[model samples]
Target: MTDLHFLPGCRIEEITRPDANSLHICAEARRRSGRCPDCGEPSDAVHSRTVRHPADLPCLGREVRLELWLRRLYCRNPACSRRTFVERLPGLIAPRAQRTDRLATAHGRVGVFLGGEAGARMLTQIGMPTSGDTVLRLVRRLPLPRRPAPQVLGVDDWARRKGRTYGTILVDLERHRVVDVLPDRSAATLADWLRGHRGIRTIARDRSTEYARGIGLGAPQAVQVADRWHLLLNLRQMVERWLAGVHGRLRRLPPTVGQPAGPARRTGAFPRSQGERVASADSRERKKALYEEVRRRHAASEPLLTISQRMRLARGTVRKYAQAESFPERAVQAPAHSILDPYLAHLEARLAAGCENARALWRELRDIGFPGTSMQVRRWLGQRRSAPAKTTPRRYREAQPAPVPPDAHAGAPALPSPRQLALYLTRPRDGLTNEERSAIGRLERDPDAAAVAVLVRRFADLVRGSCIGGNAVVRAPIATFKRWLIDAQNSSVSAVATFAAGLQQDAAAVKAALTTPWSSGQTEGQVNKLKLLKRQTFGRAKFDLLRRRVLLAA
Candidate 1:
């Protein structure tokens, strides 16, 4: 018979199909003598024989299984500990492994790239029958290669369960690969990891105090650099706080020409009914009482937890009230149900088409199953018509004065919200839209807002490394930043003063952030990747599996 050499050093004896999806390839080892695994001595003395079946890679679009006949050989060396050992094929498979090395490698790659159930489906489509659990096991079994100590490091924490538990990921900033993952974000855990791996020159991190302390304790020689992005983000947050404090001032400012009034202003603070006014007054009194109590407790040096327990409020609510400089106004929620909702779109379409007759619109709605009365439609149409055409440019002829609803009046002049004001203050002038520019102009009308705006622009220029000039650009120096921070601290803006204090606390890191270009931006990107990997496991995977996937896959 012609010998069919299927696998290396093995001959195929027979082939059979146990099922339509699978093919069994029976084979036997060609060598008669086997080596003892422990003693490494050749032995022809066969004590027993057995047949081992292991899965192999798919062949010709069918799942392949190998049935190999193996021998149990007796150890010939008298001094050897083992009396007998199983014959092993080192290149074909590992000891007691269920699959060949080549097949395991393919599964491992699929597991690393696609992850578990998705990988199993992909492998099944390619004629490899395996479960999601098996794919995960293969991935977890892969060995991690030893990496050299990183010269520059980036550290950040990722949530295993957001707001509850987190893990720290340390990356070699130079190579941009994750070096290790610690089980917790605690100072002790991170410090331990850092101590194990030395030779770090610089550590880039966020403004996390725990990480800062850990780095200081573990590697005092390494320079700590604060991330620039976090610094800019802190600036934006401070600006928002400052705006929040002066939001009432923003409302008092007159609206600019061509600026469309917001919904709040359009509904200009209509005179509330007696009952509505009574209810609002009651709500305000209750909130003010709570705010005062929180502030009093905070002034007495009571911690947030003690205040929360004493007041019978959640800690988060207690913290908010304590931190707030003034009692927060109750946010006006929009009416949930409106009679005009169903017909408003049609009315706008008609108005856009120059159809302004309320009676005609009422008749049209009645034909379309509108159950509302003509008077209700007329009142709504009157409000829309009376609203100043800030957005639309078309001219309209005066029509009959439709009766206004008791609840409707000219809204307060439209003004930008605090958030929009903050964006206008921080973003580049070139990026602002015409409306935003107009809003900025309106804000600058207030002397206080204008002073704050100027400081914001100067700080932004210093951070960006350039300043606007009369047809010429100029470089901003670090000295300018130092001077600006001093000015900000002395300024009347409480948010800016608080921000300046923080900069002073970490003066060295902040200065390094400005002078040196190194940053934790790469660490942020790796965190995004880590989020993707965490999601791939459907959030059920433990740390060991997650660590292997991140390190080995990289």
Candidate 2:
């Protein structure tokens, strides 16, 4: 049966199952002639024969063993240097190999997706048993894909070990697949890689100086587009820094003359009882004391790390304490309605009418949709009874109390964190909720915040492809960006001014980012995927094996 397609050019003389888990096939090369090793001459005289048992792909849950007969042919040419040469069956198996090419290919595929240990376990479970080392060897031996250099390339860095070692990843934007992974993130390495791929017409990357210098050194003619995501991220961080300096603007400010309070101050919950109010007040005091202690230790020039260890607090909390110039006060919020609110008047009326039985009042209210238990009614009455009696004289109480100005901070909302305010400033206005919109309105009370928001929105819109090129030189938005940059450069907020200066330094890349449509988004996505593949090996795989897996697995 020479029809066993896997062993092409070979004939099967006999096939039999030796055990339940395996099958054996007696096979030999069908070729009768072969070329001499040293001289280019064909030979048909068989000089010797040898037997080999090579393993192949599993067949129907059984291991396949082939009894192959390889023949040695005698060189008939008198001028040949070699006496004899073995016939090469390249289509079937490799020289001196213990397994067939088909089996190796299958194992390589398994190794590609699941690294060594996992692949070995999977192969054994699937009845094609093989060791992890063999699987890894097969994967490493695989040939990488061959393709021409891409015109549009994306480049970004990935952390080999975050905040420590890093590497660069290149992607073909058109194919959305990784092209290569460099061991380190450096200008020389990227320059070398880019020089080799001269076909690149556009290179999309982040606003990193190393990458920029590398591109200039290697592919000066290629256009460099800064990543839009990085641009907006930088903007948000600037906004956060500005907010940090002006923390008062992010909170609900005391009402000014004729200015009304915004809806952001609306409360979300209420104290369930008198005891709850007391408990909340006590908790606030405890928090105040702890904050004071943290700030006190920090002001003494103690390292925040030591403070965190002594206090059993997070390092971030310690840093926040050290950074605050004053104790951040929480704003007051109105109490929410409770289930007992509707029944309160009825219970009071009964108590005043000499019907002081709390259980009877609770039962009466239960018929009118009051879902609370009698214990709640009892607690309310007991609290009222336990309150200290007022000692004011009845005659003096009738006199009008001195006129008091309204509490300006009443019903104020708790201040949003700097990061939260930054999100509101950078995110689209259309996506904002009613509370966020109100917060924005409240924040605008500070003229500086209003001016900063205008600049932030303009920058965000430009980066998001909604450029406002009104009265620009060529309606190309480049002029509009320049004008906005000037406005930010002169801004009172140092954070925004600093960021604007950075943009001016990288003017070319920033401008190219606005004009070009390609970005480093694909490159960033590939880096994230690389993290997954790296973690698959528990971070133990060397760079060579990881690179091979990344290339071959693709």
Candidate 3:
């Protein structure tokens, strides 16, 4: 209806909605006296009057423009700088700003959250039109907050470029806010920062030796706690290494192509399906023809490149074919198991029964406990719908599908990868999938695997306390960790022993982690946020801008 109010010492003259998307307000400052910024002297003498047009916050989805009339007051005192000055609006628009303080704050906040380009686009759509560069300028102009030294600090490193460069971020653990970001994760840089803020009582960090050394140099009195997650991660890595050492024994080879699938023997070749066999035969026939041609051309003194170009094959392949005494059969690798294995037969049966609509078939399969999405079903349906007339004909309409080999991988499941098995060991028993549960069951049957599992579970309990024998759980974790360390060191598994030795090197931090509630987990989450901001700028931001964004903003 009207321009209700403005600055404390200003009066509104007129309010007009110029268009459907714009609001213009005319206001004037009615100050009794103004102060000269140069000499801090009160002046009532009017040198000249001036009109200021500044942008305000949008009103009712329309852009707001403010035209404020103010006086250019002259300094009265001779002691003050004898010059005219534009009167200031202390709580509204700044002396030289083109927008209200509140509006600039809104732009700056958006810029900090979304960064330049995205913030500018967002501001334009929201009726505060501004350029990306302007938003960035506003963000950089924002003053950094004065934060006191944290009582408990969480320190961690984030890669500026992974495996090449790294930076450090310190967070106030109690307040859960980023305190500052450093250029590098070096001990000296962190030590300098820590020395400056001497009030830190505890420091939570990862098991990096650099950080340990830094903490030692910076604040020796501060209690250093190793992150429990890192401790667990190190154990998993050790488990993987042990698995790697014995991988040959753990891995079962596939049966040779021509041999009937039986107990896994040291077969040199892989199994092939009937279709793969057909495909391989056709491929070999074509290669044999090509090989003959290559040999004939080679005998005629043709260049390898010429032969390759003529045959549309690689020179190496042509040379290889030409060099062979006979056309060698291409080795076939075992076909990987697909997600459609369980539903393949049922899908074939349904297709034979004349259900052709992929969408309907997908819904039917979904009702019968199918886990795959409809897109896979649709694609498979497209292939199967045409495969009937091609691969399968009326002559083989009544023929049954081939039976799976009794003693093959179908009967005895394949072993999981070493990294996968290590994760399975680290994961909670109750949270495992049914297949993972069965896999672990089979793994425990092995004496080596059984011993490793026992040690891993014990170490896990020491770090993350477990309920044992109905409420008689571990209370003194540091003591438990010490005993576990001795047991792990004496274990038959060399990898486990190696892991235990590493814990002994940083026994204080390890013990502190087991006993204390603090961790660098929160700091890790902040690093992820930092990464998001860095990537949003397409990795072009330097350390200074990145530091400002990470520290000054949330």
Q: Give the candidate number with the greatest TM-score.
A: 1
Record all residue pairs in model 1 with backbone atoms less than 3 Å apart, i.e. clashing: 261-414, 265-411, 265-412, 266-411, 267-411, 268-411, 268-412
lDDT of 3 at 295: 89
Encode model 3's per-residue lDDT on 25-46: one tens digit a residue. Answer: 8988888889998888888999
lDDT of each: 0.77, 0.78, 0.79
The sequence of per-residue lDDT tens digits that candidate 2 reaches over residues 11-57 is 88888989988889888888868887688798889999988888888
TM-score of 1: 0.77
Better of 2 and 3 by lDDT: 3
C-alpha positional error of residue 16 in candidate 2 after TM-score superposition, expressed in Å:
1.7
Q: Which stretches of candidate 1 lie over 4 Å from their true place?
A: 1-6, 46-48, 81-83, 114-118, 257-305, 308-326, 330-355, 358-382, 385-413, 466-476
Candidate 3: regions farther than 4 A off: 1-5, 79-81, 252-410, 466-475
The TM-score of predicted model 2 comes to: 0.75
